[model samples]
Target: MLREIYLSTALLAAFGLVGAGLVALVHMGTAERIEANREAATLARLHEILPDGEYDNDIINDTTVLSHALLGGGQHLVYRARRNDEPVAAVFTVIARGGYSGDIHLLVGVRENGQVAGVRVISHRETPGLGDDIEASRSDWILGFDNLALDDPPMERWAVQRDGGIFDQFTGATITPRAVVRAVRDTLIYFDTHREQVFTPIPVDPTDEEAHADE
Candidate 1:
């Protein structure tokens, strides 16, 4: 009986190890494909917000990280768009807090002159029919932000119309639209304050240094 118990324990341990190893192998196999899909989705959103042809450089490769309270206080990726090496616009992946259900993820593009290029909702948990109108597929409301600037609306009028602003709020979901409006405004302010830093070139890699040294 003692020998049988030991054998059972050994088989269980071996099975556990095999299961773990299989999981690791599956993860390793899918890792690149998963990352590639994520990158493609992100690039699609970027193009939707910033538009194609307006940028010549590889926007995905030319990016910088920004962390600020206005940007939801977490490190956010800022993709800079340029034509012929001149800055065209900067697209920010920002988080909108205070949503009705939860946070709303956004992609806001601002031109070099401070005007808003466009805005797109990357993801959100707002009410399907009401707050979901903030999405381009659901409504044209998001397009109202195009070409707007901090001064054009006088900044204070950036809120939803219910709050004495130029934007509109969903009939049954004011919090979600309000949250998105505030977040977009904050993102513009963040970009305005850090335009220079946003466009700053990324540092060289050590591997590149080694390759150059080889020459």
Candidate 2:
């Protein structure tokens, strides 16, 4: 009886090790493919926010990470676009954490002129019928953000109508829209103040970036 138990335990451990090894092998084999697929998906989303012809550089590879309180206090990726060796716009992935259900991720493209190139919701867990209206497929409400800037909306009016802003709030949902508006507003502000930093070339280093002053 005791011998039987030991045998079963030994078999289980051996199987577990084999399973782990298999998983490791599969991960190693598919790692690059998985990463490529992810990059393709991200590029698709980026194109939605800032379509082709908007810039003449590889936006995907021209990126830098930004960590700012205005951007939800988390590390976020900023993709820069340039044309003829001059920066055109900066695309940011910002988070709206006051959504009705949970955090809402947004990809916002702000032109060098301070105008918004476009905005797209990357992900969210808001109510399907109400808060979800922020999505392009669900409704064109988000389209209202195109060409917008801090001055366009007037900084003071960067909130849902219910909150005395020019933006319209959903019939039954205000929290979601309000959250999105605030996040977009903050993102624009950050980009405006840190335009050079936001559009820093790929693999930005703090001391190296400050060298812009000499150049």
Candidate 3:
């Protein structure tokens, strides 16, 4: 009995070590490819948002913790769109809570002029027929927000068509769409308020500051 237990324990330990080694090796081998794919996807998204010229930096999260942008001005905005040295986009992945069914995931593009360039629905669990219309594929309703400026009108003016506003709300699913609209508006407002801070480079750590002071 003692010999059997010892053998079992040794086998388990060996298996655990092998499993850990495989995991580490897989991570090491795929890290570069995963990063490259992320960079490619980010660049594609940025181009879809700007589509004007080539950008060099990955300025995502520069404006907001969850956002990024490419920082050159042309006919359209060009953001370098990078993560570390790997290129990516200056994009925001926004989560709008309070939807009728639940939360909605939206990716919103903000132009340099503080206008909304476009919005894409990343995911949602709203009432299928009623709330899904907010998606780009189901309808063009979400596109109504494209190029809308914050100062264009009052908050009341941002409601859906059923509520007598510029946008349209689904027949029975008003709350879900309404939540998304409000969230988008709030995000834009946040961007406008923090534009300069978002675009600027993050401050270096205190260690760097102390080194400078010493110098």
Candidate 4:
């Protein structure tokens, strides 16, 4: 009876190992394809904010992760665009933390000359009709950021009109648009302060290279 019990335990252990190996194999087999699909989706969105013809490089892969208070205090991805090897623009995925409901995610594109190329709301929890107008589909308000600069409206006047600024706020949902304006301005400031680092290539980890080689 003890021998039977021991054999049963061994068999169960073997099965567990086999199951884990199969999962790992499946993940390894599909990992590259999964990554490719994610990259494709991100590239499509990036093109929406910054035209594909504006830059010649592979903007999707030309990215770096950064964190700063001006960028909502957590790691955010930054994509760089170049024309003839010269910096053209940088797109930042910024988070607006003062939204009426919660955080609002934004993709802000700023050119090398400091003008805003474009801005898009990736996600938001603002009110349906009022705050939701910040979206391009809901309204063209987000497009007003194009060609704007910190000095264009003056740093002090970057808030919504209700706050004595240039941009207009939603009639019933002031917090949502206000948060987005602040976040975009903050992203521009971040880009201005970190231009060199923003365009610099991310260093490759030796371990990562070795792992790829092994694969």
For all predictions, the C-alpha RMSD in Å is: 3.4, 6.2, 7.8, 3.8
**Per-residue error (Å), model 4, residue 98:** 0.6
lDDT of 3 by residue, 27-146 (tens): 988998898899788656555565534344435433334333221111222243433444333345677778887868777777667778777777899888888998878988888887
Ranking of all candidate structures by their lDDT, best first: 4, 1, 2, 3
- Cα lDDT of candidate 1 equals 0.91
- Local error of candidate 2 at 56, Å? 2.0
lDDT at 32, model 4: 81
Candidate 4, which segments miss by more than 4 Å at Cα?
A: 1-30, 204-215
The TM-score ranking, best first, is 1, 4, 2, 3
Where model 1 places Cα greater than 4 Å from the true spot, the runs are: 1-29, 213-215
TM-score of each: 0.84, 0.81, 0.67, 0.81
How do the residues 2-116 of candidate 4 rate in per-residue lDDT, one tens digit apiece?
9999999999999999999999999987998899899898998898888899999989888889999999998998999998989999999999999999999999999998899
Give the best candidate by TM-score.
Answer: 1
Off by over 4 Å in 2: 1-26, 203-215
Better model by lDDT, 1 or 2?
1
Lowest summed lDDT window (length 10), candidate 2: 196-205
Report clashes for each candidate as comma-separated counts.
0, 0, 20, 0
Which pairs in model 4 have colliding backbones? none
Worst ten in a row by lDDT for model 4: 194-203
Tens digits of per-residue lDDT for model 2 on 1-215?
99999999999999999999999999987998899999999889888878868799988888889999899888998899899869988889999889999999999889999999898999999998999999999999999999998898789999898888999999899999999999999999898789878766665588887898679
